[model samples]
Target: MRTSIVAVLYVGGWALFAWLGDSWWQLLVAVALAVVFTQLGFLAHDLGHRQVFRTRRPSDIAGLIIGNFGVGLGWGWWTTKHNRHHANPNHEDHDPDVSPAVIVWSEDQVARSSGLPRFISKYQAFWFFPLLTLEAWHLHIASFKALLQPTAKRRGLELTLLVTHFVLYFGLVFAVLPFGKALLFLAVHQGLFGIYLGCSFAPNHKGMPILTKEDELDFLRKQVLTSRNVHGGLLTDVALGQLNYQIEHHLFPNMPAPNLRRAQPIVERYCQEIGVDYLQTGLVTSYGQALRHLHEVGAALREPTREPTR
Candidate 1:
């Protein structure tokens, strides 16, 4: 039923785009498509975690379809990277999520930056939300790059589906709309889609504990401490793709997305009983915490240099 709903909305959005001629409403269609695409992306995430199917093969097949073809991201690449993140949620060394790029999550990573990156790191917290507008395109590019590498797993199938996706996606847009409208459609769709994706995932671990190579903890503790739950009712659940239950989802990666809500109370009680710091906050609050953390890490760069005494 969930999959059916997602398919309908996604296809309907595309159909609406095809149906609309030269009009300002195409931009609204772009927003609608961005939303539906993000939902499909969450479904793809579930498939990658094998939470949607009983066996690995079926899930992988579904992931390839929903993730690669529907969403234009490589399922194999995503799964490999995501699994490593689960194994070490916020560990600087192992978790690709925290590996420094545009924004530094820790002071150590901020210190390591030099040249252009160093300059950027100083203002990264301010730029984080804005930069997220490009994240979907970034992931798409990363997916193709990873799949094209010789060492990538399931390279052939992933590449094929991804290529097919771009062909159909661009083909439909360009065929139906004028060049300028096509450009606007692509820009709005990809930009809003990326922001939606980043907003959903960043709050999960951004402000939580940062683990290092030498740090070790039990699985439960590690997952709980490094994850934050966003508080809202059903709307939040649907918007964030059940990821509002981040602590529960991280603790039980293979649990079905629908089941995460039910598991939240149990997980929260368990954390309380065990004396773990289970963080839960409103969406705005969580974003603030994440940005504040980013700002704090970048503080050294933002500091003014003192004048030398004569």
Candidate 2:
């Protein structure tokens, strides 16, 4: 019930902003609501895995409703990709989401022969979201792919959810508010939400070693290899939707964002006992580091290594 209420509040807030709201303060409120919807992505993520709500039916309903209504993320596809990512964090083949988002890894043989090309490759990638609005690109591509997916036909709710999303978005974009103001509100709101999602998610797993299949022989091993946490102050936490604590969240997907701090010590001890490298950093320092590491990811991918189990 709480989750459902949260979902409604998110959409409701968006509606309020899209209609009568005005000024920078209202824009911030809209951004906050959008952030809530974005964070709902994480909630659905946990629920999809049945780690949040536990009951399969309830969790699935929660995930599907939030995913479709709040973020327009295809629940099935997101789950497939996310589970695979957990199973194989950075394996080039198994983990399709092993992003080139930032040039964080070291360059390999392929990049060495080239200079400007190498730099450009990394530079363009690091700026993927910021430079050219890759969020828009991703949404378009993902929407198209999901719509055409044969599996989507079997997963009947996808189209309904997407159409509802369109109705909501378009209703705000055209029917509800004045066109000019609505576009402006949507633009600012999306900008903040996009940065929020990208910063929170990209830094979570990006700089971590893109481990191979063999590295993730077990669940515990995969958690250690695939995940790390970031810690920042209250403002950063609020802005990033408490996702700076990425490693902790990954380890305990069911835990709400607000409780991560209290859970940190416990998670840290576990990481220590397991000998896991609990990667963590504060806002500015880690922010700079994440950017640098993103540029070097392509470099890391190319290092010579024996193949692992696929």
Instruction: Give a tens-digit lDDT track for model 1, residues 1-310.
Output: 8899989998888878778867779999999989999999999899888888899889888888989999899878888899999999999999999988777788888767767667777878889988988999999999999998999988888899999999999998888889998999999999999999999999899988899877889999989999999998989989999998999988889999899889988989988998989899999999999999888887887776722111
Estimate, for each residue in 111-213, the C-alpha lDDT of model 2 and write its tens digit: 4425544445534455555643346336535855876777664266776786687677767555655677677666766666666666667766665666643
**Strongest candidate by TM-score:** 1
Q: What lDDT would each prediction earn against the true structure?
A: 0.88, 0.63
After best superposition, candidate 1 residue 88: deviation in angstroms? 0.4
lDDT of 2 at 124: 44
The C-alpha stretches of model 2 lying farther than 4 A from their native spots are 1-12, 18-30, 99-120, 125-132, 213-219, 233-242, 252-263, 297-310
Model 1 lowest lDDT segment of ten? 301-310
Which of the numbered candidates is closest to the native, going by highest lDDT? 1
- Lowest lDDT 10-mer window, candidate 2? 301-310
Error of 2 at 120 (Å): 5.1
